[model samples]
Target: MNRKGYYSIQMQAVCDNTRKIRDLYVGYPGAVHDSRVFRNLPLCNSLEDKCGRYYLLGDSGYPLKTKLLTPFKDSRQLNYNIKLAKSRYVIEHYFGILKQKFRQLFHIKLRNITFIIHFIRAACVLHNAAIDDEFQLNENIDMVNEVLPPEQDLDFVDEEEDRDARRVRDDIVNDLRM
Candidate 1:
């Protein structure tokens, strides 16, 4: 969906601590921003615990929500923000493994977005299955890193600024101080 002749689809994924993808959403046009894709997804309703005790850690591209924690914009390297950012590595690692195992995702040349989405979904499922089979990817880690582009700073939009979400973030910051 790029204006310059490139067409592809985006994937939004959630990985557990086990490095296995727990939830995957695909089919958003490549031109669409990641935050929009995440907003439209029903992950909040489906993943929120009854006790409201669980939360998912997301990177800068995701909006802060009660159920999803994001680091402060232009963070000052506070301990709380440092910890959250450090913990977010798991999901990034999952993506790296998926793209490494399914080279198609590395440069999705398929014109049909639907097909690209299906391919990505299948890759995610296979990635998880491989984990279950005790697959070791340590050897491929360096090779994958070599081909991948350096991480870019994403421009995030605060689509829905909820006071409650801010409160939750503040509470976390305060707790870290204690």
Candidate 2:
């Protein structure tokens, strides 16, 4: 249980530029830190092999790795941060779309954790299928007024930044400046 006195599950997902979920990891308790949950994900183990020349964008809660790029804490790289934020919007938008389609995700009432995990995975798969089929939602449905759950606490202990990842980030920032 989290400090908020509610049981929760932590879910992690990786989406492509098209807003389709490429990978997902869930079933972690809500009390677990974001970094810890990410590290335990199967995708984290094969990230290097899965993404050869590409890097995944992550928020500050995650450690900067060769395959995963987190924003620099320093404010000098404003342009780089801005560009990264724009690119990162795809994943955020995917979550919004997922919740909009599967309202059960907003407050899943299933008592079985395993079942909840399966249900979430099924929703993701169906979401991808819907995208492939070019399914459109009703225009009359109010998308702006949907109330979402409160954001989870994301503060985590800073992991040691990989020197190679730092160098890679620096190169990208320099390239952005040119």
Candidate 3:
């Protein structure tokens, strides 16, 4: 946490299967990237007692490991890499909500590294607490409950349209595979 002088530090958070953030890691200022920073999280003896053990999902900026998740490849893996890849975006969206709601963290007036990271962590804890405290449905904002419906269904479309859309997606996915 002593490292400082760069605004390019990576931030990390462990999310639940429901996509609610269970833990947060603001990270030390420097070259520590997602993969290493992610694995460095203090692990507990039992996953039941430890949060985020469902898995660590991160962006391509993060490294891939049995303990951490990233995009899938045809390359052999011990687990289902493809599924984790599809789900990692939730963490990115969580970050978006965080920055949007707590803008101060992004623009901490304090120059000290510990203060910057600590302030962010404090904000995240508050945010998580708010989420934990409030379970009411926000109908005015069209906000859904914490638990989401399984495998959201896309807009209703004809079979032909769906097939064509999927073809385009498959093409893009295939291109990325190359």
The CA lDDT of each predicted structure is 0.70, 0.77, 0.53
Per-residue CA lDDT of model 3 for 37-136, tens digit only, reads: 5446664222235533444554445433334434433444313345445565566556666776788756678877777778788877766776788744
TM-score for each predicted model, relative to the true structure: 0.78, 0.83, 0.56
Worst ten-residue run, lDDT, model 1? 141-150
In candidate 3, position 28 carries an lDDT of: 56
- Best-fitting candidate, measured by TM-score? 2
| Structure candidate 1, residue pairs in collision | 1-7
**Better structure of 1 and 3 per TM-score:** 1
Prediction 3 TM-score vs. true: 0.56
Indicate whether candidate 2 or candidate 3 has the larger TM-score.
2
- Model 2 C-alpha lDDT versus the unseen true structure: 0.77
On residues 1-178, what C-alpha lDDT tens digit does candidate 1 reach at each position? 4567676567788788788987778887766877777778878555565225878887666677877877776545356666886677777777777776888777777767677777778787888888899987764222112112223235543545556777888888888888
Model 3, position 108, has a per-residue lDDT of 70
- Ordered list by lDDT, greatest first: 2, 1, 3
lDDT of 3 at 105: 58
Candidates 1 and 3, the one with greater lDDT: 1
Window of ten residues with lowest summed lDDT in model 3: 144-153
The digit string of per-residue lDDT tens for model 2 on 105-151 reads 98888988899999999999999998789886543322222222223
